[model samples]
Target: MKKKLTGKTALVTGSSRGVGRLVAIALADLGCSTIFCHGRSEASCRETARQIESRGAKAVILPAELSDPAQVESLADRVLAAGGVDILYNNAAVMHPWRDSPEELSFEDWAWSFQVNVFALVMLTVRLLAPMKLKKWGRIINLTSGIDKTPQLAAYGASKWAVDKWTDDLAAALAGSGVIVSRLDPGWLKTDLGGPNADHEPEAVLPGALVPCLLPDDAPGGSFFRAQELRNFSLD
Candidate 1:
């Protein structure tokens, strides 16, 4: 039988490592024909690209610094030029160092966190939305977090809150438009961002990470998915 996403194209940001890299490879294995692996530099995504190809999918490396608005726009422009993607996985994010006191967190740290985690993600989403609407089919998965009450990581937590709000609003607007936008929490994993103290391995993000992408066309938008909750779930 043909795979669910056969012939579909997808873009997985921050895919050079960690959760994004694993998700990108999973998408390829599920039959996404063209997988755009994005990272901070082309070299960073080479291994990801190789893995995608090994899974029988073509990989295109697109590099951009999410902290820079110009680079974000350029990244979106390039993807649009190549004919927009069918699935968009906004998986890139940044976290500020934990400050013993929340008051000690610098404004610059908060600014940088929001710039990469929220602003850049929204910029890419809106820019690529038109094509999806026109085609009447698209899946957008925005990565969010479950961090709470940890003032030490307030900057990161606040940024994720902003992502949740934006995702909710966008989903409402796209209702009945055939473009689905949802937020996904990959849970605490032992990735660079998740740190070594996290509860699960990065590999545990699979199956659950791919859940939103495989939702039915009639599936409602603005839903929250937790990868850990679906840890033992099967796509088949």
Candidate 2:
């Protein structure tokens, strides 16, 4: 089959299931080889890789605990070994239940949440940026959360906000360099993280959420985006 992303390769973290899984599948279907990284579940990771391969894109499964910096570095090495990652989907995050109450949350809890959601995400991006810059073409999609009102999810929300701000800044730093960085809010969806009561299904993120990652090299970055539309795409 003819492919739009024939030579590209995408590394999607937390892709063993839910929205990340669907995104990986969609990228593979578009003809981009995929690298699936998921923590704690080898079976699930294998399953996702199998699906990606079945769609005709090569699949690589590399499991690494995001909370650990050493593991994150190891994963980066493996990704670099794959001839450099052209697309990076920062979809992994930690949202512990204890974070539901700020008064009851401990310093350790907050630190752990930030470690996975912010530190590791930033670390992995820093580690991988060199190759993308050298190649002069790349897409870095950082997933953001839209539930700002969740008092119980303070850590998650705050960390996401940090990433959103970082994405905005990174876009400016990467301008004219052929590397695009954008924040994508997938909206509240039915996933393990989103819970069963979320208004939309995980599949709802497709077509719309995928648009930013598919933008042209000359497209401006550091923009915010909802799954439904680019934050800066004016209808007027």
Give the number of the best model, judged by lDDT: 1
- Please provide, for model 2 over 155-189, each residue's C-alpha lDDT reduced to its tens digit, 9 standing for 90 to 100: 77788989988898898899999999988888888
For all predicted structures, in order, the TM-scores are: 0.98, 0.92
Q: Rate the local accuracy (lDDT) of all candidates.
A: 0.95, 0.81
Which pairs clash inside model 1?
A: none
Error of model 1, residue 2, in angstroms: 6.9
- Any runs in candidate 2 off by more than 4 Å, and if so which? 98-100, 229-236
- Encode model 1's per-residue lDDT on 1-236: one tens digit a residue: 13789998999999999999999999998899999999999999999999999988999999999999999999999999999999999999999999998999999989999999999999999999988999999999999999999999999999999999999999999999999999999999999999999999999998899999998999999999999999887766
lDDT of 1: 0.95
Clash totals for all models, in order? 0, 0
TM-score of 1: 0.98
Off by over 4 Å in 1: none
Per-residue error at 225 for model 1, in Å?
0.3
